[model samples]
Target: MAWKFRRRVKVIPGVHLNFSKSGISTSIGVKGASVTLGSSGAYLNTSIPGLGIYNTVVRPG
Candidate 1:
């Protein structure tokens, strides 16, 4: 087996963006809120009424 030599080139400028799935949490931070998830499922159990995001919990009760 033979390997071919490739030239290294810098990325183009303009149109700044990122593409990666290494560690991107889908759920955003829910500060001052009570949100939880579990093997059963995830739910937004807040008496705040129409709460968007607050916090995340492993075992929600």
Candidate 2:
């Protein structure tokens, strides 16, 4: 089964709200997390816990 999560944390100082998540993919069951800003802006990071897959995965690999 595929699992997904969503949480709103401190994305930025006062202009944004974060939508964080893990395991949001269809091909690979990766443990990476993404921290994106409110609507449209540069992203903070994409980090995996143990495996360490930190890169912009705009399209699946």
Worst 10 residues of 1 by lDDT: 20-29
lDDT by residue (1-61, candidate 2, tens digit) is 9776665444344333434463221222224544443333434455767876677634223
Report the C-alpha displacement of residue 53, candidate 2, in angstroms.
Answer: 2.3
Clashing pairs in 2: none
Task: Kindly report which residue pairs in candidate 1 clash with one another.
Answer: 30-54, 33-54
TM-scores for all predictions: 0.23, 0.23
Across residues 1-61, which tens digit of lDDT does each residue of candidate 1 receive? 9654433222343211222332211222233443333344444434444665444345433
Superposed Cα deviation of residue 33, candidate 2 (Å): 1.8
Q: Candidate 1, 39: how far from true, in Å? A: 0.2
Model 2: lDDT equals 0.42
